[model samples]
Structures are given as C-alpha cells and as structure tokens.
Target: MSTRWYPIYQRGGPQLRVFLPNFWLKLVRPTHEQPPNVVQFACSMEMTKYDIQNYLEKIYNIKVIDVRTRIALGETRRVPVKGYIVKDDDTKYAYVTLPRDEKFVFPNLFPENKEAKKDEEATLEQAKQSLSDFMDKNKERPNMPGWFSI
Candidate 1:
C-alpha cells in the first residue's frame, strides 16, 4: 500500500534513475599568453584533475591530454560603512591540454560592425543638422517651445 507519507517498495518497480554529476565547467579566456593546445577553464572547486579530464572526455567528448588545476584566492575587502571584512568566493581554474596538433582559439563574442557604426554616425549627424536648422529658423521667436513649431 502506498500513502502520501510513504510508499511500498516493490522488487520490479521502476528503480532506474538518471545519474548526473554535480560538476560544472566554464571556458575562460586566458589572461596571459598560453600554448595553442592549452585551454583554460573555470570549474567547481571540489573537482580534481581526474574529474576534469573525465568530464571533458565523457561529457564534452573533447580529448584531454592532461589537466592541471589551481585555486585562486578570493579578494578580501572591508566594508566602508559597516567596517566588516568580506571575502569573495575562491575560484578554481583548470588548464586542460589538448593533442599536440589541436589548437584552441578564443572566440570573439562581440564583433565590431564598421558599416553599422557608419550608419549610426550618419543618422546622428542628420539629426544634429536638422536641429541646428530648426534653431536658425526660429531665431526670431526665441521664446517659443520647440514642439509648438509647424
């Protein structure tokens, strides 16, 4: 018998459950120059080198030749008003090395559009010129509101 508080366990019941690891990895842009085959990643502090390698191999399907981890100490600061010390959470960085021939390039998340910029500048210039012309035409009626013009 099954109740709201408890349920009866059966031998052949659905006992299968999906397994998920409590690990997270985020690709980070390298601050300094690094080898082309080396990729930087920010990951959970609890994850080890082996875990990182296995995660990339099994989950991401990326071949990892080696993984090196380092823990960066969080910044400590004192609140100006309360005068209490605060510290940020520590971050774990993983350096994963790929095959000798593999190269990892950091993607440009924000690309500049020269054409769009030129168009925006042209629109702004037109608006400014129209405003100047309107001001010149209304020089005789300086006290009139801008919206009251025909």
Candidate 2:
C-alpha cells in the first residue's frame, strides 16, 4: 500500500488500499545541531505522523522510535524588477528518531566545482544559440533592436 487516499468504510466494511502516492521527501541538513540519533527531513505538507512512520519503516527499512512534525512558515520577498510581494510555499519539517544504536548524516549532493562549471557551460551554450538566431533574423536590418518584433 502507498500513501494515496482510500475510501473510508461506512460500517462493517473491508480494508481499503492505496495504489500510488506522489509525495516527495528531501533529506536536508539540519539548521541546528541535533543528536546523532535524530534525523531531520523536509517532506510534503500533506504528510501525517502515521504516513511518516510507515514510509520510513516500509521504504527505508529503518525502525522509527518516535516522530514529530511541524509546519514552517515561508519567507516573503519582493520581486526585484516588478516590486511585487511574493511568498514561498510553506514546508513541513519532520524530526524522526531512530533506534538508540543508529545514526544518520546528510549527504552532500554537489561536492566539487565540476558540477557548477558544467551548468555554466550549458547556460552559455543556450545563450549562444539565441544570439545567433537573433543575428540571423536581423541580418537584413543591421540597426534593428532585438525586441523590435513580436
């Protein structure tokens, strides 16, 4: 059974099953130092205490001793150009406790400079294509601005 919703039994009904769930959970670095046995996770807002317990127990094969969850408010920011207000989506944070002998540390997703260089190259390649297309389109009108046409 997955985390999808199931119809509730009216009365003396059989159990229901969930076939699919699209929830996402990211293992993030803890903002504050925590005990070795405690692991912090940023999960989908729809997740509940029972869902977390089941996910860890069934998917990760980890035994959870306790679980606590809280919803964190997102920060508000102003758009640089438009000067309009924008708010990020709130996130659900879960602090899961593992067995006494177990411990967890967050892994580094990008550890070296190679990944950043690759991303820069990719962006530059796309920009070069766009510039070439613009120059070709404006070859007959040398002084035309890039945004002259729709």
Candidate 3:
C-alpha cells in the first residue's frame, strides 16, 4: 500500500505522490536587475530544467512558465596549509519564470522586534555600566590588576 504523507490517503482516496529530493535549493538575490516575474535560485548542481520545473510546480504549488539553468565553474586555488591545489564545487543557478501577472519579492529576514530590541538595549546598557564601573575602580590606582580588588 502506498502511503501519502500529507493527508495519509488510504483506500478509495486520490493517490498523490510527493517527491523528496536529496539536494537543496537556496533562494538567492539576483546578481543583476531582473523582471518582477523572474525569480532566481541556487540549486543543486545535478538539478535539470525539468527537475526544477517539477519541483516548483508540485512542491511549492508555483506555476512556472519557463526554467533556465547555467553552471558556474568553481574556482581553483591552493590550500593554505600544505599549498595543495583545491577546487570548489560548481554551482547551478536556476532562473524561474512566473506568470506575467505574478511577481515575487524576497521577504525581509531581519525585522525589528520590540522584545529583542529591548533585550539588546538592556545588554548594551549593562555592558556600558560595567565598563564605567571598571574605569572608576581603576582610576583610583593606575596599573593595578583588576583581581586585586573585590
């Protein structure tokens, strides 16, 4: 019996299969300005156009009009320690085209949070007070070790 992972589909249910790829896809900012409909992604080197199309359509439920991919050759350099030649892994860049009406913008990963900001400010204040206290204690006697005082 084939087990559907999403809804746990069983007998008499519409059987839908999910493809889990061993590789990973990283959403990357475009090096150059691109149309709003075009989204750039850095994917596994082994991924093909068809694989990328299938992955977006089936997994992300994104309708992809076209997919173009290119491989960027890795740089060859000498290792720091033994000066042995080493080569970095080649990377594949996939440009996925969405429908003209649709546009995608990268979301902001770091947004201001009130609680986090407060915590950061508190930590900064504590650090400043600590430094000032240390300076005051050291001002009484110059060149004295900090461990000498309580």
Candidate 4:
C-alpha cells in the first residue's frame, strides 16, 4: 500500500531501493510550559502518533515512552480590502515523552552581544545628529527639498 513509484524489479536487475517517508517534522518552541521530558514538534497533518514515534526512534535514535498528538485549527481572517475570508492550514502537533530520567532543553539560537548593541546605538545617534544639523541649516527654507542641499 505504498504510493511511491519505483522501477519494477527483475532478476539480475538493480536491487530494489528504499526511500524515506515524505514526512516533515519541525521542532517548535512550546507556547506553554511543559515537563522536561516532554518535547513538542509540529508535524505533517497526515502523520499518525505511531509514525511520529517510529520516526523519532528509528531515524533519530530517540527512545520514546509515549506520544500524544493534537491538531491546532488555523486562524481565519477577512481580507481588509476585498471583503473575502481566508483560512490558514491546520497544523498537527506531537508531544513526545522520553524516559523519566531524560530531559530536553531548547537551545538559545540567538545570543545578544552587548558590544554590537552599543555600536548600533552609536550609529543611530550619529544619524540623528546629522539629520538635526540638516534641519537647522534648512530652517529658513521650510519648503526646500532635502536633496537641494549639498
């Protein structure tokens, strides 16, 4: 019962090849607090709880104790100008539980750099000062275009 198409097998022909399932799983930050052993993932809508469990266990080599799945209804909104309604695609989420002793922590992907922040602030101030100077120079000609100045 596979939908994937492959070349027909024949004697002495190339060995039949196996391909991975066309399932996608995205690791997303949990909107609400969860236990350390529970990890959240947004997966393809067609994926079943067993599929998720097997995917993690066989592909990622993670031992799964339990798997819970839920579907989040997508938001619906009206187009501001056309008066038409639009709906977003629904998302399926999987909550995987590992062994009691295992813990999963989301890593910090973006770390703030104080030095870079200070440099950005300094550049903003300089731009502000130059704009103020330009305004002061054009105080006498309110209607003059900024590009007219040197």
Candidate 5:
C-alpha cells in the first residue's frame, strides 16, 4: 500500500507509517507578543495536530514541546470595479512551542536594491512594445516580410 493510504492500526496490525508527507508550513509573524520559544505558522487547512508535530519534527528537525492549532476567518472585501463581494480562502494557524532554550526569529525574504524581478518585467514590457510598434508600421503593407524594412 502507498504510505499515505496506510490504514490506522486498530485490530493489532503493525503501526501505520507515513512517508512523503505533502503538508506545507509558512512561518509568519505573530500579530501579538508571544514567548521567545513559541513560533506561529500558517499551514494547510487539512493538517491535524499530529501532522503538524510530525512535519516539524521530521522535516525541520525541530523538537516541539507542544502544538496548538486554530482556524482564522478570511477577510471579505468588495471588488473595486465589479462591486461584488469576495472572500479569501480560510487558513489554519499552528502555534508550536519549542524547548525553553531555543528561540526563533523570522527573516526577511525580500531585500531592497534587488532589481532581478524588475529587470525581467522591464524586458517583457519592451518586447510587447516592440511588437506593437511593428504592427503599427506594417499597417500600410499587409504582406511585407518582417525583414524587408529597417
């Protein structure tokens, strides 16, 4: 049987083994003050307490003292132009407590003066502008080859 589908043990079968778990967890800043050893995470909605514990212990190699989870309601907003109401997907939050001595701080993923994405966007815009200019210049000659002009 696939590792994911292994049935839970009840009638004296060997313990179920979970391999290649597909859960994802994103570290998030806590809106309120918290203990140094406690970290907040936003995770997939389907994860249970056991799943969270296993994910942290197995994937991150972090020893978890305790875990608590709760579902946060998504905000409802009105579409700017369509004047229709929209709601974002609800998310699950996990509060994981580590050993008393271990503390975690969230790192900044995006830094200033890094124009990698901006350069890519600029290139794309330039290509689109060139195509538009070519189309405009070809208005007088429908069948002329692209290389025929300067």
Candidate 6:
C-alpha cells in the first residue's frame, strides 16, 4: 500500500488487505448551536456515513452513536471588476453524534478582546517610558527651543 500498487487478482484470490487508510477528518466549528454530544466536521466529499463512523471509532477512539452529512452549495457571485461569474467549490459538512453522555466544546483559537486590551496597555506603557526618558535626558536643557539640539 505504501508503494501505491494493487496486487493482481486470480479466479480464487486471497482477501486484499488495506495497510493504510489515508482519510482526513477535520474538526470544524459548528455554524449554529448544537447539542453537547453533537460535533461538526468538514470531511472529504467522497466519505460515507460508514466511513466517518469507522474513522472516528478507530482513529480518534471516539464512539459515535450516529452520523449525518450534507453537501453545502458554494456561493456564486459576479466579479466586481470582471463581467464573469465565479463559483466557489462545494463542501461536505458532517454532524457526528456521540454518546449522549459525551460533550464537545470547540476551543477559541483567536481571542481578540483580551489580546487587544493587553496590546494597547503595552503600547501605552512603552510611550510613557519613552517620554519619561526624554524628559530625564533634557532635564538641564528645558529652556532650549523645541527643535534645537546639541
């Protein structure tokens, strides 16, 4: 399987074995509110319900109760500068239901509020320090013109 080859088959052939399963399962943030046991995922378009179930159960070790999938149509828009219309690629969305006792909470990857405040505070502190240092350096030359320097 790693060599990317398939063995020849005879009339009575041995069962084919799959050594590697290269399926990608991305954990996507839910668009809307969902039950605690339900998790959203953006998966390969060719994946089936059985494939998702097996993937989660075997790879992730997450026991899934059920799986539901839907194809989201890509938006079509007309280019503002060009006179042609463009369409986005379609996506497949999967909603996996875990055991009722299980819960999944998506973590906040980008936290803007706290980071922005901390950044603003840092800049304010930096400006204050620079101004204080400037005043200290020119303590004895206060009467000089603003633009004049030694």
Per-residue lDDT of model 1, residues 1-32, tens digit only: 11124234547876654456778899999999
lDDT values of the candidates?
0.89, 0.86, 0.87, 0.92, 0.87, 0.86
- How well is each residue in 39-149 modelled by candidate 5, as lDDT tens digits? 999998889888999888877799999999999999999999999999999999999999999988777777665588889889999999999999898878888987788
TM-score of each: 0.75, 0.59, 0.75, 0.82, 0.58, 0.67
Clash number by candidate, in order? 0, 0, 0, 0, 0, 0
Candidate number with greatest TM-score: 4
- What is candidate 2's lDDT per residue for 53-103, written digit by digit as tens? 898888778899999999999999999999999999999999999998987
Top model by lDDT, which number? 4
Choose 1 or 6, whichever is better by TM-score.
Answer: 1
Evaluate residue 32 in candidate 5 and report its C-alpha lDDT on the 0 to 100 scale: 97
Q: For model 4, what is the C-alpha lDDT against the true structure? A: 0.92
Better of 3 and 4 by lDDT: 4
Deviation in Å, model 2, residue 60 alpha carbon: 1.6
Candidate 1 residue pairs that clash: none
The number of residue pairs in model 6 that clash at the backbone is 0
Give residue 71's lDDT in candidate 3 (0 to 100). Answer: 91
- Runs of candidate 3 exceeding 4 Å displacement: 1-19, 112-126
- Candidate 2 clash pair list: none
Angstrom error of the Cα, residue 55, model 5: value is 0.8
- The runs of at least 3 residues in candidate 5 whose Cα sits more than 4 Å from the true structure, single-residue gaps closed, are 1-19, 108-150
- Order the numbered candidates by TM-score, best leading: 4, 1, 3, 6, 2, 5
